[model samples]
Target: MNKIRNGSTVVLLVAVSTIMAIFIACGGETIREVEVVKIVEKEVPVEVIKEVPVDKVVKEVVTEYITETVTETVIEIEEVEVIKEVPKPVQVEIEKLVIVTPTPGPKVEETWVPTGTFVGVSNETYTMSGYAPDCVYCATMVHLGVQESLFGTKRGDAGELVLDPWAVSSWETASDFSYTDFKARENVPFHRGFGDMDANDIVWYFNSINPLTNPDSRNDTGGQMGGTLLETSVVDDSTARFHWDAFAGHTLFKTFTDLEEGMGIFSKKAYDERGEDWIKDNMIGTGPFQLVEWIEAERVEMDAVTNHWRKTPYVNRVEILFVPENATRRAMLETTQAYAGNLPIKDWQSMFDMGFGLAPESIYTVTQIAMSGNYWEYSHIKTGDTLERVRDISKPHVGDPYEGGGTTFDGNTPSMQQSLKVRQALSRTIDRETINDVILGGLGEEHHLGYVWNNDPIWQENADAWSLPYDPDGGKALLTEAGYPDGFDIEWYVGTGDYETQQAVAADWLSKLDVNVTFDRQDYSSWRPTIVARTNSDIFGGCCWGPLLWPFEWTSNTSSFPGGYGIGMELPQSKASFNIKNGSQDQAELKAAAVDMLQYLNDWALFPGVVQQPNAAMYNPDMISWQEMRPYLWMRLGGMRSFEYIQLK
Candidate 1:
């Protein structure tokens, strides 16, 4: 018998032989020569079998037969004795083994080397005003690295809102949330030979932009300031304190850090010497770029600051040209004449197909219909007696637009605007799907509520109840029931750009409901002042006002409330907003107040939202690299691209 072990298996071979006795006594000698042969085989006894323990950590010896190589060798245990039988001989062959070890993974090296000149084009021209830009387009110059505020706010890598240290090093709020103290960074130099920025510069900048302090200063962004900033006091050369009238500490800080409305800190000496006219044409600030030449309504050229305190500009220079024609901008990008440009949705796919980078961002801009409830023609006669009652009950506790001598709809006779049924009927006449698909080229979200984002939890929860179903027949019936059986004539004012096309499409859909509409196409420059001054007494169709940068601003008296500086729509939700602001800071109380305000706005439908359009821009990826674009408090300004972080690939 013989035994051999291979890997996990053990084999045993056994041989047996049978012997027959000779019949004759004389054959006894011959029988002694009996031959042995194999007959039967049997397994070894259980008691004689050696047991191999399971789950034991044993080194495996692998042998390669092809080249007779020993792949692995385990010398832990010595060879055991082999069992043998003399009946026959058996041959055994051995294979050589070789050992092999795994190699480590490849290493990855990543780096971003910044260099080159960045050139971009814009559809709108920059006004380059002294205090505030006439148009929002001029504000993009600050984002282009020419100017910076005391503090900067942006979405961090983790998607949370973060206030980054810029001119301001650190800050803290008061216990009552009425004020915030900011410590300015030291040794931050201003461009164009202005001395370093300090607490004095901070105080001067805010006061210059504040309408209360500098009445001569043209602050188009004053509306977004929320009328909360009372004063800015210089505590010392390195620190400053911002005081507010109400408990608006958080909002006040946000307003200072906001990319659009927030005033950029300027050199007090420069302004005092050069004056407002010179400051308009020339910019001096603590930024990564210095303005070289700014040709009003034509082009702007800036040179990069090589040794900036915060971050040096990667590009040597930045040139922004005003190409109002979309086709011209598109051609520039295609020909590589411009590194980046504002792209229309219709041209986005084509640009992307051509290997250009496409950055699409969600802006605070929404296109909606602003029905002037204050118009005597639309006034609700039935509610004329209750106008005073509504005004008294819904007046806000703070931030009253009427305080600034701004007229509200409170004194207007309540007419059709007071009827919820009429508003709902008018809302139903709008074909949001058609506008989103046709006019916007499928680059928009259908919104149900005004001012509030559709994705917000408050709106999401009550969207169904707030949304008006698109039913022209039902709308016609409702209109007839509201005493306009044959439809009423409305003077529809449509501004230039997307608004012109959108309102035209909407007017077509509204005609199906027997609504008589006359379209008045006007340029944005002319239309903006009219809307801002509340001179558009008739139905003014335009894009929704830019996003109220802060959530609290959404409830500010200037935005959603009547008897306040409203955006044409006279909604009676000011009391709710005021109550929420003055109410207990308790989470539950605030949430309840917010919910009540949202419910009131939804029921009123003061401004019927159409669609939230996406803002898109095209760039050359080979020349530039950037993170995801953000609205950065401005819809038209290409998501506030931080020129400091943008690297040239």
Candidate 2:
């Protein structure tokens, strides 16, 4: 039966090449038989028989297979267009103005010799009058290499602050931190024939400088160390024991080793023989440099000590010229008359464009507004003397424990609560971002939470809660709520450092709240005595002095010293500071206490931070190739240290 439709066709094709070859081998003349079938349009089939050659059949079969394969593989693809929306282009303008004309620096010599006089122009004067070890400006003498402490600060392998032994060789503290025995290095000679340094000299040095032991002593650091430093005794010629009521070894380390506030060890022989008045004008220390003369408001000349015990100065002589004018200092550097000068931040790029050398990086220093006169302590910690608290309850930013004759740091007190609000208002009124960008030239970052760094663990956790926003309206509301609807007058003290411009900006912001701010601009040396005495109740525009009560990773209280340069800040967290100074060995406990104190500071806004800026160095490339030596914690703006290792190019 045949089942083939009219439209549908079924075709069968077979290839029998092997059978054809067999038949051909049998007889080349033999004829091959073939069959053919035909079907009509209807369901009718017809059959026909035909004969074909084997070659013809094979050719026909191959042709049909190729045609069938080609018919099955025909496919057509359609093309479509895709439309996408394009965003509008934004136009940006770029200005490429030259700051200064490029100039070649001084030519370098083929043979280098580190034996020239280095003249450095500084914006600040050396001191107001005296060279006393306890003076705030005494650190300048130590930084200039004319004096050294028993211990000094240096950069560790990780660029961390480490203690560098100078006069002292080794130390051992009691288990309870009651006392520390320091072994002094022998044969350390003093300048101008003062004789060798000994344990007796160390004992005399600490006792005489401390106001607690010597009532006539005028050292400001007496307030910081006097409470804990009970006595100093000589064990032998090279050993001295410092007895403490309570001591934190780290706090002692920070206070004793600091370059800014540390007591510069002077010769006891000179002090005894020459008297206090002679010692005040003269400097005698076991340092690499010996002071030749200091002309007031002019220059301080020093000659390098040959074969110094600690370090031999590369330069033969050093001259520190007091150049208050920024332009004059820059001019001196450009003319090659000054090896180094403290220039302004705005001029740094221009100076570099003119072939000047800068430091590898800048040292960071925090600037804060110390809301001074927060007298919360009822009595003195050591002497049990009746301490006077803030009497003026009307002062906007002053906290008084004696408010309404109150006897405690009661937060519920009217004056205390009002002062807190005023502080918060002042902090919020500040435009730190704008000030950092404009005044600091982007070299500073917004700083808050007192002395804590931006990325510190405590700051990271509490940043959201602790950070005060820039809200002028909010500040006004706070001031109004604090009973200052018409605002108030504040006497803001500005000392040395890069603070004037920033303070001016802050004052402008403050004016919006009807706050009349009066700035008292004076030399820091003159202001030092008042600040140390805690006599002024006015606010200061600077970092807090003394070791920070907070346990920072760097362990540098001076880095962000609380209490506003040792102002009389008696608060509820005052005992925390006492413990830190007393020498608590427990790190975790200390950190907790520090964090608690920071919280208190933040909530009350007593000591609010503005921004942290860089203290950079700029020098002539030809005069110096390398200027770094030991670590310098806090120096003035554009100030350079470690003069002994300055390499001449």
Winning model by lDDT:
2
Candidate 2 TM-score to native: 0.76
lDDT of 1 at 124: 47
| Alpha-carbon runs more than 4 Å astray in model 2 | 1-114, 128-136, 258-260, 360-362, 496-498, 542-565, 636-638
Tens-digit lDDT string for candidate 1 (521-610)? 443333445444444454554333321212343433233222112344334454445435442333344445656665765665556777
Pick out the ten consecutive residues of candidate 1 with the lowest summed lDDT. 42-51
lDDT of 2 by residue, 108-225 (tens): 4333233888888876653422335445455566667777787886644433344666777667667555677887877689887879898988888788666556755655344445
| Candidate-wise lDDT, in order | 0.50, 0.57
Error of 2 at 230 (Å): 1.8
Model 1 stretches with alpha carbons more than 4 Å out: 1-115, 132-138, 248-253, 360-365, 373-414, 417-422, 441-443, 486-494, 514-527, 538-566, 582-584, 627-631
Pick the TM-score winner.
Answer: 2
lDDT of 2: 0.57
